[model samples]
Target: MRAAKSAYPLTWRIMDALEAFAAFVWPARFGRAIPWLMLAPALLLVGLLVLGLWLIGDASLRTLDTSTFLMSETYTLANYRRAFTESLFAVVAWRSLAGSLMVTAATLILAFPYAYVMVRTSSPVIRKLLLIALFLPFFIGQVVRAYGWLIILGNQGMVNEALSLVGIAPIRLLYNYWAVLFGLVQYMLPFAVLMLAPALTAIPEELEAAAGSLGADWLRTFRHVVLPLARPGLVGAGLVVLTLSLTDFAMPAILGGGSQDFIANAIYDQFFRTSDQGLGSTLALLLVATGSLLVGLVFTLFGAGTLAMGRARQ
Candidate 1:
């Protein structure tokens, strides 16, 4: 009985010591609120997105009965089949893909040199002015910008007038592939510059200086040092531009001018013009799928580029 009483007191004292230490190290009550506060917004956003997607999917499954404009009943795959078998959808998809690729490539080619100069130059005034100029177009609405392009590219517009002054007949520039390409590049160029500028700035100056000292010229340094470091930014920017160009309805709708159409425009036409909700849903889903795939590919490339860069540095 005496031994048992002694052991109980010792065990209780150890437990009290552990409890005091834990309380001193970390206050259990205070930390609970922080995680909950941080998690609330994320949970709310996820719930809303899931709810919205579910509603869209539900609406997509139902078909409109022509007898009554409001009457929609039955689920069918006919809409999906129509989307695939129909030349209109296929043509639009192909055009969107091709146009997006061209626009992305063009933006990269144009923005890279500009971005490099902006990052490497020691002139603050020039850099600030150029940065402001790059972002100025975004201050204007896309529709307004599109209309401005219309004025510039139209037959009776400034470009044609200039050509006429030079003794050349007004060439067809508006409402064509070139016009669309021009508009897309103009819109996407700023994004490319913004992405590339940061990446370029992140590159250490010593790398370039060392390369020069070792007999590597500017082009060689850029190829060996700058290009590899900038790969992630390039891939990210390209993906963003490509996706924007692919889904962009306003540019194609305005500049394409019945000559061309993208998947987004096709979706718009189905929903509003033809009253084909099912088909439109399928097309929308396809657009989402394509965007997801493009994003996945970009991240994969980015990961590989990052890993390769790390290995090269080692």
Candidate 2:
């Protein structure tokens, strides 16, 4: 008790000195201008987001006429009811969720080996070239990329032509579930690589070497050492792919045709084609909520901090 009392005053004195120094430095370096400089971008982003939401909400609140094909201000939940009951919006939402999950799972399986090879390879030049190729597709606009898929998957396109030459009938590839999945996986592959690469690279070589020294084979070392170390990256990559697929509009709009309608496309139709702004907003909000919940669940299950600590003990 006496020793604790003696330390308490010293701690208080040190804290006071730190506080005084902070006050002097804060005014001298930041004063009024620095805070504004730091805050401006954040404030601007918030303002824009709020404004956009407000505009969408306002548009949704207006009533639409089926007779004259006109919209007017008579706020109601009829649009929301119609979205739930009449439009098969619920089915679209389910499809979106399922498609996102499938794409995320497939991308994870595909990307893990590539990411592991990229990080673990001895050839730096080859790794650099491969990374460049992986990310190169991102430089092209999404619309162009989607159209490229269309050309490749179309009846008279490269894929069909090659299949025709093989004497097999041209497959019905375009405007289908497979086409949408292919496009989504291609679009999100770069993200998976980016997320997984850093985590793989950060794993200490000593851990793998130690495992090997203990008579563990390469496969065993990977199973026991590398995978556990990279679980966080796996989870993070899945979340990115899942969220992107969930909110995706372009690929579904272009590749899905009538067969692959997602929630985002449904929302677009409501706002633009049907002019049911309120229902669109509600759908948008639902998408946001669902994405957030899934992301939160992933983090809860495989957070980086927990996984890191688990690996450290091994």
lDDT of each: 0.84, 0.84
As a TM-score, model 1 comes out at 0.85
Lowest summed lDDT over 10 consecutive residues: which window, candidate 1?
304-313
Ten-residue region with minimum lDDT total, candidate 2:
304-313
- The residue-level lDDT of candidate 2 at 89 comes to 80
Model 2 ranges off by over 4 Å? 1-37, 54-62, 66-75, 304-314
Residue lDDT tens for model 2, 154-222: 988899999999898988788988889889998898889888888888899999999999999999998
Error of 1 at 120 (Å): 0.9
Candidate 1 root-mean-square deviation in Å: 8.4
TM-score of each: 0.85, 0.81
